[model samples]
Structures are given as structure tokens and as C-alpha cells.
Target: LGDLAARRFAGGDRAGALAAVEEGLRYGGQAAGHAPEYARWYARGLINQGVWLAWPLSDEVRLPRYPLGPRAGSGPSAMERAAGERALDLTRAAVEVWAALDQRDPVNRRGLAQAKVFLGDRLAELGSAEEAVAWAVDAEGGFRHLLRAAPGAEEAQEAEEALDHIGRQLELRLRFLSFDSLVSLRARGLLPEPLLPQAVVAARIQGVAEPEIAGGLRLDAEQVRTMLEVTPWLAVWRFEVRGPDGLWNVQGHPSHGATEVRNRTAEDIGNELIRGFTASADCPGEGAPWRLLLWWHEEGDPAGARFRAAGGPDTAPEGTADTPS
Candidate 1:
């Protein structure tokens, strides 16, 4: 039924496609609940159902639907949100079942990573920025590990690219204090219109210089500089963990004696800092002491040289990314 639904969706049979998916979900749910032995088969069905539901089969723009911000109604339509939530739940459950049964299955792990990126995209569309970033980070870490393990594998590179795309999308959401602000600026001619809004936003968030931004959008440097000057600047603050197994905290102090301190906490400082950072059985049990910092700045400073240490190790390695919480 899920296969039929996918075919129907591809064939432009909206009614048939939805009906088929509904049937698949109904029967798949029943099988998973009633038959313990057939759990794996049912899990596969759940994955298929999720794929069909979440995949963009129509011309409609799914996630990141325009007019961002709380004022623009509650994020995605009710039906859209419901479908996305269901897809995430089903895919996550399927991944969990596969993980428990076959820890070393590369195929299933890759599929799980893809599903996470897909779910993360949906979550971002629904305006869950922090959660979306976490999911994207997990997928990126998995893909990075796979790429490292199998150098030059096409699938690993593809997965890594997908993770990067999702990361860029999440970064855009984080940079935009309000989506409406971006649109309004563009309308006022302060920001040059770009063909790929996501690309422009992503480059801007990464804080590339005027020339880079201009080349990225095929605009002149002067225009890019003008956009930067007029664009509303929102500081991208991150909480990074260094070392230790104990609880750690990060506090943000905005310049000029700000009363309210914005802070984020990391439960496990060491493991949370770096994705591949792991404890070895042969090594001593003691964990390294990690530092945290707060950074505030406008966009378009020199790459890797933009961030000033509001806090953290004075000799922290240059360009070392703090684990984004």
C-alpha cells in the first residue's frame, strides 16, 4: 500500500495517493501493535509511510513557508504539521528498532541519518529552530563519520551534502530574528533580491565578506555592502562544552551592562563539545576540562577571524567550532 501510495503521488493522483497512505498507516500500525514477530516488517512499513508523507511530491512549498515570525499565524497549517509530526515519529521508531537489532548495519544507519535530516527539515519548517539544529548536527556527525570511515564513497558524500544543506537551512532560521524582516528589507531595496533566498541567507549567516556575498548572489560588492549595512544584525551566540562529565553552564553577557543574562547549559561537557570525542577504555578515566564562551558581532567580518572571545579559553585554537547547543 505504501508503494502504491508513492506511485500514485508520483503519478499525480492526489486522492488515490492520500487514500493509499492512510491504508498503509492503518494496517502498519495494527501489525506493529499486534504481532511481535513481524516487528521488523512493520517497521519497514512505517518507514515507507513516513517517506511518502514527508516527501515533496507536489509543487507546493513544504517547509520554510514564507512570512516567518510568530505574528504570521501559527507555523505550518494544521494538516501539514500533523503529517510532519507523524512522519518524524514513525521514522524515529523505525530507526530505533533497526538500531537495537543491528548496531553495525551501515545501510540502516545511513537510512536513519537521512531520515533524521528529513525530519529536521520538517521541524525547521514548523519553526523549531533549536531542535532542528540538533537533529541536523546528529545527521552531519553520522555522515562525517561515514565519510571518514569510507573515504570517497559516493553515498557518504551525498549524505554529507544533504547534511550540509540542512545545516545551512537551520542556520538561516537562526540568523533571521524575524523572517518578515528579511522580506521587508528586500522589498525596500535595501537588500538585493537573490534567486535562491536560502543560499543568500546561508552565506550571510556564515558572515562572508561583501565580495564573497556578492559573488555568491551574482551581485556587485557595493550592493552587497549596502545590504550588509542596512540589514538587521542578530548575533549568533553558541554554548560550547570543553571537558568533564559534570554539569556545565554558559552565560551570555551583552555589552553595556545588560541585566538579563542569556544562558545555555550542557549536561555532559566533554562528550557534548565534539561529536567524535570519545573515551577510550585504555586511557585514564579522567576527562579534560572544557571552556565555554559568548560571542557577539555583526555579519561579514573576515572568515575565522570574526568572533571575539566574550568568554572561554584565551588560547582556544583558531577556527575550532564550539559544539552548538
Candidate 2:
């Protein structure tokens, strides 16, 4: 039952898998305490609980604590800081025990790689990106072997799929580890606008008095209104970006999220910007000459209407990416 629960839980059926763990706890309570077989199952239950909570689930909120900070309480507390530390300890402990078991048991060696990836991931969450990268790489290698050994086998496919997901982990970690963010973006070309930075831009656009376009800027309502007439697709909506720090609506104290936008300038995500113009799309101006606004948004404070130039893209990476997350 314990192994079954772990399997189910790993496969994404949390409620069913969790129920199995509960049963294992009830049925194998004494046996797990005494027998070797039960011991593995018992340890697995704890590990499964940890992994389940870690995996994405609706409303589950994956431990919601940053790696550094004070404890919430002598136990878990009224404050968020103490709770973060407690959660970290539990996550680390579960992953560690699982590592010890698989290392000691050669029979489970095939599954070791995946476990390593999980360990690296949990460790990464705890702010150890180096270890996280190592474990993920190991897991990627394990999946490769599983794929080759089984060729057409379902396990091979599973291993390959798991490898695919780790790519995102690597993406998130790139922010901290020394990496060329612009190179990555340039390689992708037609990028997703580095969502966070794009959000900041949108929020800034939203903050300005739409009417203010009349004076501080060259384009007045008459021109902008007329421009809108030519381009029907020019609907301006304000966007709020969420940063590593938290929800940032453009108007907030400095944060890592703010940095995301600040970096997107030519350095990070590449200076991808609004096209040469935002022409009007309306009647009378139908298919008329396009007007160029040359507007660009970059990261940082006093953050409205400022953008760094990105000389054209570095050239498309030469191939297609699976999809932008």
C-alpha cells in the first residue's frame, strides 16, 4: 500500500495516493515499525507527502516561503518568517531520507535519478541553486538511460517527459546562476516579452494620465485619436506583473520583480520593444500611412516611457522551441 501510494502520488493522483498513505499508516503501523519491507514503505509515505506538496496542485501553494529569514515561531508561527523555516526543514528532511534509502538499495537504482532531480529541486528552493543544477543534470542523464534502455517502452517515455519538465527548472535557476539572459532571449526571438518586464511596462502605461498624452508628449489626442482610427488593434490595457518578491502593480517599493523589467533592456531578455509604430485602425483612415511612435519601456524607477534600444534581434536561433512557458 505504501509503495502503491507513492506511485499514485508521483503520477499526479494526489487524493488517491494520499488515501493509500493513510491506509499504510493504519495497516502497517506496527509492521512498518518492525519489518524492513514496512520500513521502506513507511519512509516512502513521508517522502510522498513531501513530494505531493511540492508538485503543483490547485490552491496548494507549494510551501509559500522564501529560503532566508527568521523563524515564524518556537513552533510554526503567526508570522510568515518562522513558518518558512519550518516548511524548509520538513521538505529537506523528506528528500534527504529518500536519498539515503535509494543510495543504500541497489534495487531502486533505476529510480535514483528522478529522486536526485527532486532533491536538487527542493535544495534549489532552499537557495542552493548549485546543488539543484547538479541533481537536475543527474536526473536528466538518468532519464536518458531509461529512454535508451527501454527504447519504445512506456517507462522510457515517462523518463523523457520528466526530463522535459526539468527544462523549466533550469530556466528559473538561470536568473541566479551566471548565465547570458539576453543570449537566451535572442536565441528564442519573438520571445514572450519576458512577462514580468512586460507587465511592468503595461502597469506604467496604465499609471500615466491617458489625458497627459496631450502635453508632455508630441502626440496629442487629435493625433492619437486619428492614429487609432487607422489601427483598430491599438487597444491599450494596463498589465500588472508579479515578481519574485510578490505582486507588483508598478507602484511599489523596489523588489526583485522590478529588476526583471530593469534587466529586460538590451542586457537580459534583449531590448525587444514595441514595434516601430502603433498605427491607427479605424474608418476614414482606412489602410492609411502608418505613424511610428518609437516608444520603448525598460526596467527601473521614474519608470514611465523610458526604454533602451535593442538593435534588431540577434537573428532567430535557427530552430523552433517546444513552447514558451
Candidate 3:
């Protein structure tokens, strides 16, 4: 029934596809209640239904969508949001059943990590950053154990890479969403006028370094301390990303000598930060980077460019001109 639903949806019959999935879910639910031996298959069905509901129908059945929410600036539509929530709930229930029955199974471990990562992403989209971080942390811990236990397994490797990507995104989201970071961007006129008040206050509850807050907002350290005394939510996390490669790491910048603004607002800096990490370059010699290929962080890399390069809209290769096909 699930396979039929997928095919129907791919054929552009969304209503029929949904009806087929409903029938599959009904059978799966009945089996879960009556036949203990078929629980694993039932769980698989639930997970598949959850994924189908959360994603758009495409002709390629094997290709999977990113389990995370949409990009930073936009959000899922109402139906998408509801489907995502349902998927998370169904996945959680399925995982619980798997945990009780298959504690040491590799399939269960991977499934658990994937579900947790998706749950974290959904929570973050719903404005629950702290809860989202907690879910990501749990997923990271599981992936770390899997990596150590099965060094050569593709599942373990994939799980580790997923955690790495999730960690990077969560860091960016935390920094960008923080109140102090948004205010700093606003003060520097980097943020759009409407987004000035949309800072994430999660860091406020955790408290922040006084000097770091001052540096970000271009105020004296004492002034930052004074402000924190009254409105602690104004405390900020120092944002810094520095490297020269296809891969870059983000870290918290300390307050010492941190006042060099590149004459660009924080929005420009943020965009550049994304561009730097996602950009492709020629290799020093004949290696991976030098080949005629594409560079991408992942299917869901927020940088968005999967071909040509990052930093700007894509273009034809240097010697070629773009022409309508």
C-alpha cells in the first residue's frame, strides 16, 4: 500500500496517494495491536508514512528529502508544518517500540539518530531552540558511539556526517537568533528593519560574556556589563568563522581586539560566512578539488548552491556563456 501510494503521488495523484497511505497505516496499526511478531514491519510502515507525509512527491522513489525544516528565511506552509509534526510524533512512537525490542540492532541505532535529528529540526522551526539543541545533542552522542563501534560501516559514517552538519547549523541558528547578535546587526545596519526585533532570547537565560556582548555591539566592556545588570537578555554570543578551504569551522570569538568591521553589515558578513564554507576552488594539483565536479556540504546545505560555486548566483563556466537551451 505504501509503495502504491508513493507511485500514485509520483504520478500526480496526491489525494489518491494519501488515501493509500491511510489504508497502510490502518493495517499497520491493527497489526501492532494484534500481532506482536509484526511490530518491526509495522514500525517501518509508520516511518515510511511519516516521511511521505512530510515530503513532496517525486518520480524518484529512492531519493530522500532532507529531514530538516526549510531554510532560515522562509518556513514551511501550514500543511507542511502539520505533516512535519505528525511525522515527528509517529517516528518517536516507532522508535520507542524499536528500542524496547531491538536494543542492540544497528538498524535501530541509525533510525533512532535520524528520528532525533528530525525532531530537533522540527523543534527549532517551532521556536524551541533549547529543546532542539537537546535533541541534536542526543543524536550526536548516539552517532559518536556508532562511529566508534563500527568504523567502516556506511551507516555509522553517514550518521556522523549528519551530526556534523546538524551541529554546524545549530551553532549558526543559535548565534543568528540570539538577541544580542540581532541587535549588533541592527546597530551596524546589517539587518532588515523588520527583523531587528526578532532575536532569539535562548542565550539570555544561559547568560553571556560581558566583553563579548560589548564587542559585538561596539560598546565599552563596562557598558555591556551595566546593560546586562538590567536586561540580561541583551547578552550576546560572539560570532566568528575563519578558514580557507571548501570546509570551514565556526566558533565563538573572544573579545580581545574584536573591533575590525569589514565595512559590511552583519547580514553581509553572515552571507559571506555561508559563501566561504560552501564555495568550491581549484585544487593545488590533480586531486578531488581540481576535477570537473560539484561541491556541496549536503543535500540541505543552507548555502543553496550545488554547482559552479558559492558566494553569488551561479553562472556558466568561465569560458562559456549562458544561453537559453
Candidate 4:
């Protein structure tokens, strides 16, 4: 049944594939009750169904990245979010079953490791980077032990590739500066006006209350809360600033810089900040000495429906851009 579902998925019949896996699990459950050997098959069926539901929504998952690109179609649909959550639950169950089976039969150890890797991938896609890395490390250790136990096994090459992928992902994750750090930078005046919106978003994501965010960023608490409430699809696509030298300091990059701003209310607030800054007598004559670039989109817009706004000396003329610097 698992094989049948796989074939259907490979043939581009995702709905059919999911349906087959669901049916298979029902029969597998009955079989597993009487024949314990069928338990592994049942677990595999669960994983197949989970993968089918989750893989299509992978584009919606946001990871920390430098010069971050726009998300797909304003963000994940309700159906996609539901499917992703269900997938996470199913993969967790499969991992538990595999772990239990591996305890009694060592042969199932390989299955357990594979399931862990799958679980890790799902977690990473769903924005649990730390947990994902933990599972990946555990799975890599298992694969390494397997390689040592059988030096010439066919799976050795696959294990090496998995190890390499895990290492690369871990390195990327390590380079990401936390949102908390970004907020601190803003507090110190290291970040410019354009990034203020992103800083507010970051603060909220980090569990800071609306009032604290308002006080810290010098924004109105009611306005901040209203913006957040109205713009459920708003997100930072990039968070970076470029100094006089023209070199970008991207936020998620190892250099610790940040970009991207979203939402109309947020944009209005950011514009007010830019206007206030530029109007100040202390404002630098070289146009504030930095350029901030941000990409944003409204809900229901196409993926390519992005508008760029630059704050500082390099900004386009007032009427030519989405927002004035």
C-alpha cells in the first residue's frame, strides 16, 4: 500500500496518493494488531501520508536568510497550514513507533534513524530550526554508527550525503542573528529608519508586549496593535542596510545586518520616522550615510507583486516609489 501511494505521488496525483495512504493505514492498523511485523509498514504509511501533505507547503516555510526573498502568494493558505500541522503530528507518531520497534529489534534502527531525519526536515520546514538541528544530529550519529558497523554498505554513500547536508544547514542556521539581537541593535541606533518596521515585527515575534515595543521604538501602542491585527500576512522579506561604501550588511548574514519591510500601516509609520529623521538639523548632509531597501506586498497579491522602498539619500523621487524616505 505504501508503494502504491508512492507511485501515485510520483505520478503527480497527490490527492490520490494521500487517499491511498489513509486507506492503507486503516488496514495496516488491523494487521499490526495481530501481526507485529506489520507495525513498520503502518509507520511507513503514516510517513508517506504526512510527506504528501507537507511537501507542497514547503515554500511557505520561512527560514532566516540574507537578502530574503518574498514569500509565496502572501503566505500559506489555511488548508496548507492545517496540512503542515497534521504532517508534523503524523511524523512524530511515526518516530515514536520506530523508536519503540527499534528497542526490540535492532534491525529497525535504520528505520528509526530515517524517521528521525524525516521528522527533522518537517520541523525545519515548520520553523523549528533548533529542534530540527537536534533531530538531524541524532540521525547523523545513527547513520555514522551504521557506517562503522558495515563499512561497505550501499547506504554508506547516502549517509555521507545526509551528513554533508546537515552540516551545511547547521552552518547557515548558526550564522543567523536572532531577532532579539536585531532589536538590540535598533535600540543602540545602529539600524536606520526603514528597518524600524522589521524591528517592531521582530520584537513582537520575540514575545515582547505591544506597549514595550511602542515605548522602545517610540511608536503608539494602539497603532502598533492595530497594524499587527490588520496585517496577518505581513512579514519582513529582507532586513539590511548599506552604508556609504555601498556594501550591504544583510541581517541573517554572518556580518549581522538586516532588510525588508511590510504592511501599509507599518510603511506609514516608517515614512513618518524617515521624514522626522531627515528633517532634523542633525541629519547628515550626505543623506544620512546609509540606504535601506525593503520589499513588501499586500495580501492576495501574486508572488511577483512586490514593491521596493528605499530610505535615505538614494531613495527615488517622492512620487515614484511606494513610500517616501
Candidate with maximal lDDT: 4
lDDT of 1 by residue, 1-325 (tens): 8678778878978568878867776676676655443555666666666665655421264445522323332345567667767777877777675555443656656666766676666566555554565566667667766676674567767866776686665545444332333333344433323323442433454444446556645667776655554544333333333435565433233211111111111122212322222232211223333332322232221121213222233343223322211
Per-residue alpha-carbon lDDT of candidate 4 for residues 1-325, written as tens digits (9 for 90 to 100): 6788889999999998898899999998787656547888888887878888887655444332111112333455568767877998999988887887745344577778888878877776665654665676677777777777764556778777877776665543322224444445446544445345555554553345678777777678786776566533332333345656877544343212223333333344334434544454534435544332323322222232122334556554231122110
Tens digit of lDDT per residue, candidate 2, span 68-114? 11211122134432333343454455445445554444324444665
Error of 3 at 39 (Å): 3.0
Off by over 4 Å in 2: 1-40, 52-107, 178-325
Minimum summed lDDT over a 10-residue window in model 1 is located at 256-265
Question: Tens digit of lDDT per residue, candidate 3, span 197-233?
Answer: 1222222222334455445555576654444344322
* lDDT score, candidate 4, position 315: 52
* Candidate lDDT values, in order: 0.48, 0.40, 0.48, 0.57
Global CA lDDT computed for model 3: 0.48
TM per prediction = 0.46, 0.40, 0.47, 0.53
Clashing pairs in 2: 71-82, 72-82, 227-280, 229-282, 230-280, 230-281, 231-280, 231-281, 232-281, 262-299
Between 1 and 3, whose TM-score is larger? 3
Cα miss at 286, model 3 (Å)?
58
Q: Per lDDT, what order, best first?
A: 4, 1, 3, 2
Query: Which pairs clash inside model 3?
Result: 177-200
